[model samples]
Target: MKVIDTVLNVLWLLLCGIWMALGYFLAGIVCCIFIITIPFGIASFRIAGYVLWPFGRTTVERPDAGAPSCVGNVIWLVFAGWWLVLAHIATAIALAVTIIGIPFAWANLKLIPISLMPLGREVVSTDEKFGGR
Candidate 1:
């Protein structure tokens, strides 16, 4: 399973991951340029990492997150989130057109939510034990 995941991830990177990640990276840079939106910038960078290597990992909502995350998500949506979502959707469609790219397309679709609301999400490797460090 690990080997398969690695192979899929590699293919994903070649097909669409790099382009999606680049979109996130560019958004992060722009968000960081403004002092008030720095938090959103940080979130963009976090999602960038996830999009870069989505297989073998998952993103979960943070149990302790509260109003701040909600508010931040709104701001993110207004400023950059929509753009990322569009990019992910577009890439997903393009990848889905070919039989070989179906898995990568699904991965790209899975990323849309995080791209839209990056705040208060945590990425965890699927193979890691629940209580392990």
Candidate 2:
């Protein structure tokens, strides 16, 4: 089940494999230029662990706190976010071209929001989500 599989992944991320997660965090950090994109930058750092190890971490869509970082985040999306989205789209296309890569492509798509403006988003573990289910 997707739930079970996703939970397993959250556990892995809390471990010592943080370096692997840094790759995503670093990408996000690069986009944090100007004050507007700071939230996204912070968000990216927050989700780096999940991006690094999605299987062991869990992603749940949360309600946006209503214009949490609007101006800055918007500017960020216009600049670097679009490029990251474009890159992810390209990778998805390449993976979709092959049947075996569909899953990876699907997972990559999930990274969009966090890849864009990570501010106001929270990445939690399975245990935290289900109260230790």
Candidate 3:
């Protein structure tokens, strides 16, 4: 399974991961420009890494996340999340056009929820037991 994930990740990176990660990177840079949004920028950067090599990992809700995260997520949804969602959806559609891209398309679709509400989440290896550190 690990070997398969590695192969798929390589293909994904070659085909679309770089581009998607770049989108997140740019978003991170923009968010970082404002001191108040540094946290969002950090989250964007983290998600960028996930986007870059997504195969063997998954995102899970952080147990300690609280009302602040919810508020931040709302702000994120208003300012940046909507566009990210659109980008993912667009990318998914484009990827879905090719037979080889179907899995990648599904991956992109899977990313939408996290992109929409990233503040309360953490990316973890699938090998982790329920996202424990």
Candidate 4:
């Protein structure tokens, strides 16, 4: 990655990474406390990485070639994805209400489409995949 790309990715990872991790952590704790919910918790943990670094991730209709699929992924959407999407939507609405916050609100809204369907998305860098110049 170029210096600029590297720095931006780093900053993105930092800003959202911790928030994602915390969400997953709480989800995990909930699952652990109730053994029946462990599966859902684990699913949230998987999503946390994508949530944190969504900038580099791309969601596609199909997998690249061969990728693992899980039975719990759907459940994940039901339990966790909705919450994340709601949070972002609420944030977007709140920010849009203010002129100064319009930019931030736009950023939050940008996350919606991808956040809704994160499956099959690729997380890659310009140097690592098709993004290279």
* Candidate 4: clashing pairs of residues: 58-121
The RMSD (Cα, Å) of candidate 1 is 1.7
TM-score between candidate 3 and the true structure = 0.95
Error of 2 at 15 (Å): 21
lDDT of 4 at 65: 29
- Report the error of model 2 at residue 86, Å: 1.1
Q: CA lDDT of each candidate? A: 0.85, 0.63, 0.94, 0.58
Write candidate 1's Cα lDDT for 21-110 as tens digits. 889889989989989988887888888888888888888889999999999899889889898888988998998999998877887888
Lowest summed lDDT window (length 10), candidate 1: 124-133
Model 3 C-alpha lDDT per residue in residues 1-133, reported as the tens digit of each score: 8999999999999988999899899999999999999999999999999999999899989999999999999999999899989999999999999999998999999999999999989998998945444
- Per-model TM against the reference: 0.93, 0.63, 0.95, 0.54
How does candidate 4 score on lDDT? 0.58
Highest TM-score model number: 3
Give the per-residue Cα lDDT of candidate 4 at 40.
Answer: 58
Q: If both were scored by TM-score, which would come out higher, candidate 2 or candidate 4?
A: 2
Off by over 4 Å in 4: 1-21, 28-43, 53-71, 97-104, 119-122, 126-133
Off by over 4 Å in 1: 129-133
Point out the higher-scoring one by lDDT: 3 or 4.
Answer: 3
Model 3, position 30, has a per-residue lDDT of: 98
